[model samples]
Target: MKGINITSITLYSTVAFSSLFRSCAFQVVPTGCGGSRQPSTPSTSTGIGIGTGIEPAPTNSNTIHNNHVMSDDSFGSRRQLITSLVPSAIVTATGVSILLSPQLSFAEDVQVDPVIVDPVIVAPTGEIKKLFNEGRALEQQGNIQASQRIFAKVTKLAPRFIYGWAYLGNSQVALGSLDPAENSYTKAVNLCVESRKEEEKLGIPRCNDLYLLYLNRGSLRLNNGMAMAMAKEALLDLEAADSLRAKPDAVILQNLARAREVNGLYAASDRDYTVAISMTSNEVSPFWLRAALVKFQLGDTMGSFDLIRRVENRFSEAPEVRAALAAMLYAKGDQDIDTARKKFLEIPDRQRLKYRNDEFLLNTISWPPRMIDNIKALSDAVGDAGRVEI
Candidate 1:
């Protein structure tokens, strides 16, 4: 993303689940911008850094002079290298050309128009398009099995059809096949990258396809051992695509923060959630969640409680948010029987089944344990973290 004017990184990374909030600011990657987009270099080849958020920029492929990093595919290793290279001070570049590698310069000093290439028609004899249409129809009809089958056919018919791969992944997710869904998304991303190399086209569709793929994959990685790293990569990809498209898209950023939160990267998660809230519309859930979690981690019990109250005032009907609040109240040892009864009643009947048949929750609390104790402990953790309580 060199030579590109990132007028507002904040505008693009908005808070999700809240449906409201908005703000904008410029964010500079202080360390460097390398990895995935460019070829790999020696460990010393590039660095990475980031600045505060900003408003949305115009959509274009224009080059901007600024810090850039060597292209690298190994995202985890590349991030470390970039972090080590950027200065602690706020990074600034007006029109300076930063070299990431011998071939790629961060900014060219001279403006060069983006290269546009025609998309290669990879659909096989109309079969790929047919399969894509069938997949969509099946999905709309709630026939996930049939949709996946159709999409699978599309991918086989035209492996390079990016949409085919993206749709296939989406269907796989609906079918609860997370691993296969991830693999499908990965195929789409690979096609996007390969298409760019072959066609010199950086269209919004390709970027969007790649962005969605990363977002879904990161979500799948939320509870896994690689959660932190996968979430970071997904967030980076989301930011890059948002920047390139010059559109405000807070959902990806919000989810990115949640992924970090789930993995216990509290500091990183808090920052992302805060930024997302600042950049979106007036809904307050993200702020409540992140702020409350930070307060809880800091041992400020009341602060977390206040956040839960605020969320309840706004999103009481939201099952996830309510569940979290109930968990929080229980944790604080607030034992008013009437209030507990009311809170318990407030939990959706559908979700309440977990109190009976959920093996994990049952095991965690030592099966058939006192309902009150379960409520308090789970609530506190959920409310503090602004996460859904089971």
Candidate 2:
């Protein structure tokens, strides 16, 4: 297999580590590669930091409940924003790994059975055709900005060309210009709807572009934070996309689960997550981490533990996974503090601050007063020893 660009791999690895293990305090070894057709946007790498939400605890259970309400209101709003932003970041970071690692074929290794949607055939004449192919080549080469320009010209030359608009949106997404991408996809969808009427009159088959357009648009909207009024709009688009395709993609199911999770539909989200996991049959996916978090949030401690254990087993060298496993063990309330402490102390000094300041672990861990004091002392000692520069 061709080796991925080490620098790009490091950048993505850092982002994934920082975002997923913000509270876990583990350094991640960089892995994977970007897709050839995707834009290597700097913004995608820089925006992967997850916010911490720790606060002083109340003295009693009643006060704790009140604080939980207040905290939920505040955290819920902020989390909505994070949820919207993180999905696009994750997709950009992780989606290209299959392309990068030729040794691990998706069909054989991951067992991803993607829904086979019929391809859309578009024939453009003269300069339009020349420019359209050029744009596609540029995009395939990762020259997203250049591709965007060419697609813009194509759209201008042929306003009614649905594929032109859709490709334009694709380039815009790679460039991290999501709002413009949304507009381009919306245009393609509307045009597809109009063209479908004409095709029906002529007894032509349904245009497959509509499904692709809706799928892309729905993913953008779903990842951009469904807490806004646009969530329902995103859901509708996803459902439309799902219905148009003969079979549903696992990615679509995953996206739907995330959207449902954010909408407080835990049961439906759980079902979708289960289906997606079964489809992939790969335990090390970010989706598994997400499902684990959802399970933990829903008080399914054992389920969360099982998921974390699977990740830990697969990525044993991953410090983040070890840290997470330790935290989850502590949350289980029956684990020996000494064992958890050993795992905690195994993390490097440079990464100790993240665990020390982690809001979720602090709130969830059933630490005795002496254990808390000892952990704090250890963290302070590490801070005094000097921090490692990331």
Instruction: State TM-scores per candidate.
Output: 0.49, 0.56
Kindly report the root-mean-square deviation of model 1 from the true structure over all alpha carbons. 19.0
Please identify model 1 stretches exceeding 4 Å from their true place: 1-125, 141-143, 199-208, 223-248, 279-291, 298-303, 314-323, 326-390
lDDT of 1 at 72: 19
lDDT tens string, model 1, 42-63? 1112211111111112321111
- Against the true structure, candidate 2 reaches a TM-score of 0.56
* lDDT of candidate 2 over 196-277, digit per residue (tens): 5443322223333455456567756754322234667776876776677558455556656655655556777778777767
Measured with C-alpha atoms, the lDDT of residue 296 in candidate 2 is 69
The numbered model that scores best in lDDT is 2
lDDT of 2 at 235: 67
Candidate 1's displacement at residue 382, Å, is 17
Clashes of each: 41, 1
